[model samples]
Target: MNPRNNRQVRLRSRPNGIPQAEHFEIAQVPVEPLAPGQVLVRNEWLSVEPAMRGWVNAVANYSEPVAIGAVMRAFAAGRIVESTMPEWPVGTAVTGMFGWQDFAAIEPAAIQRRIVDEDLPISTALGVLGINGITAHYGLLEVGHPRAGETVVVSTAAGAVGSCVGQIAKLRGCRTVGITGGETKRRMCIDRFGYDAAVDYKAPDFEQRLAEALPGGVDVYFDNTAGAISDAVLARLNVGARVVICGTASVANWDPPPLGPRVERHLLTRRARMQGFVIFDHPEHTPIALEDLAGWVRAGRLHYVEEVLEGIDSAPDAIAGLYRGENLGKRLIRLA
Candidate 1:
């Protein structure tokens, strides 16, 4: 591999609110020859997730954020261009936390999962069959256990995690409703992902519409967005309901952490359980979730969409777009 062939998106500055292009710097990095047990990968797809927001910030969440001047952290899919590792042959595909780069010199241990099923698009490994799928599966089943006929409402309803949550809930025979930004997303949620219904938060009477949509009262709330949308859903929780506090996409950019209506009253009134969990806590449960998720995909019960942007230079903007609700589904950057 030529040293000058590598390209990466580096963090130029810490973001104040939503990140802009000035915050990122695309540089053509030099890749050294691989070590005895290393591999050089040609990245094909990079997953743009809300979690990337926390990664770029200095915030100490479940993991440490990317430091200034470092390559912006991201999960990507790539093909092995050169390898000394026996397990990973050249031209083999893989998914891992390879960051915002077109070419990566990584050890075999750094490869999270090898792409084996040739029929499925390699991009799916970064989304429906990747971290997003695991997040939705574990967050819902491990946290928001949906019983048959229970209502499950997901925030960020048409996104990667939210879409997987809805499809999985529907597969479990639960009545599923999605809360998304626009009518188009809402329609996509129902028509494409098998969500029983969807509520458009951009509508004038969103709260009333949400109420009308889930009349049975939400039994399992997959709380992805944690501001007003969460407040509305919390208020409608049934007794003994379970709430999975996933990402707070709705409030990711709030500096003062925009005032949220107290939902403790609803918790007490309904005696519902609201638990916040980072999916990594249950690493052993990933395969359990993936097994079922893959089966669902094979059974035609799961549908996925990806909004792919090309090049590593586009990664920063692609990530920022997730916060702005510009992405229709799982936002990814295609490098190859």
Candidate 2:
């Protein structure tokens, strides 16, 4: 097979608050031929997740930050173009840690999943059926442990993981409450995702509104935004409540006068437990979670949204968008 040229997005600088276009640099790269046990893949859709911010900063305990001059790390969906490995046939659809590049050279084993059918959009594998959905599933089920007839709350309620958390809670017969940034997102949480209720954090009386929505107290708090909203959720935690520490979108930008209040008192008063999870550590449960999520989507019990940008050139801005909350659902950059 002929070698192809690819484009890749690299981290140019680290941002202090919200990342800017200047932080990313785009460059053309030459794709190498697939060696034995390796495959050459062309990325179709690239996921820009909130965890990417943690990757950029080099801080998450489990994963280090993206070093300057390196191709930005990201999970992506793509089709194999050439493969010397029997396990991954050419033209096979797959998803994994493909990073922010138009084309990549990856070992067959590193390819997490092979597509069963092309009927489902490839992007779903990256968001709902991929890491995002798995994270929501395990985090909520194992950590949050939502019980029927109890109230379940999630922050960043309109984003990918938060959206899935709310829907799953609803399916389990829990009263689901979503905390989102604006009216549009609030409406989406209730109308689109079928949350029992939603609160707009941008509203003047958000705290009171959230309280009114969850009168029985929150049984499961699947926290995606760790700031005041989490504190507010903590205050409403039911006795023996379980809090899932998923993502901290609230403090992505390390600025003076940190946002949100201390929540230790709330945790103590409610006699609740809060736990943080890294999805990678639980690879054994991935297939089960993906099968469950895929079933939900097929049955129309779950819905997903994706903000897809075309080309690797837009990857930098796409990564920056997650911090500013510019895009909805799963933010991705599509490459041909």
Candidate 3:
């Protein structure tokens, strides 16, 4: 393959707040010849996630920040077009951390999962059947275990992970409440995602609405945005409630961490358990989660929406759009 044919989005600078187009630079490079045991894949879909904000920031977090001038880190799904490895034959669909590039020449070890289930669109490998679904499954079921008739509140309720979490919690017989921004997304949380109640966090009476939504107090809080929204949810936690810190979408920067109401009092008063969830920690459960999620999707029990941006140039703006709440469900970039 010609080097000029390979296009990549590189991290030009560390973001101070939410990332902008100026933080990234697109470059055309020559594709390197495959090393022994390496496969060359042409990406079909690239996932744009809220966690990306942390990935590009200068501050340290669960994972190392993407170094300056490196290809932007991302989870992508594609088909192997050329291979020196016998195991990864040409045309095998795969999902992996291939960064923001059109083609990736990587060892088999870099591939996270081979995309089977030809019955579904290959892009589902980056959405419902991928990290988003897996994160929702383990985070809610294993961590925020909800019981029948219990109230389960999820922040960022209309997003990729939160939407799945709400639906899964409902399947478990729990009453679900979703907190999102704007009326459109709030309505989507109830009408599309099947949440029992939805509250607009941007409303003037958000606290009141949240209280009304969960009159019984929150039994399980799937905390995705750890800002003022979390503060309200923490205050409403019932005794022994479980709080799963999945993602921090609301907080702009974490380096000089934003100050907020102390959570010690809330946790102590409610005797609640707040745990952080990292999907990579439980790799063994991925297959189990995918099995159940795929089944639900086939049965029409699970519903998902995707906002797709065509071509690699759209990636930088897509990231900014996500922070602006411009997407309704899963946000993806279609490369092919």
lDDT by residue for model 2 over 64-117, one digit each (tens)?
778899998888888988888776788899988888888889887778888774
Q: What does candidate 1's lDDT look like per residue over 143-241, in tens digits?
A: 898999999999998999999999889888899999999888989998999888899998999999999998889899998889888988988999999
Write the candidate numbers in order of decreasing lDDT: 3, 1, 2
The best candidate in terms of TM-score: 3
Worst 10 residues of 3 by lDDT: 1-10
Model 1: colliding residue pairs: none
> What value of lDDT does candidate 2 attain over all alpha carbons?
0.83
- Inter-residue clash pairs, candidate 2: 58-65
TM-score of 1: 0.96
- Measured against the true structure, the TM-scores of the candidates, in listed sequence, are 0.96, 0.94, 0.97
Pitting candidate 1 against candidate 3, the one with the higher lDDT is: 3
RMSD of each candidate?
A: 1.6, 2.1, 1.4
lDDT of each: 0.86, 0.83, 0.92
For each predicted model, how many residue pairs clash, with residues at least 3 apart or on different chains?
Answer: 0, 1, 3
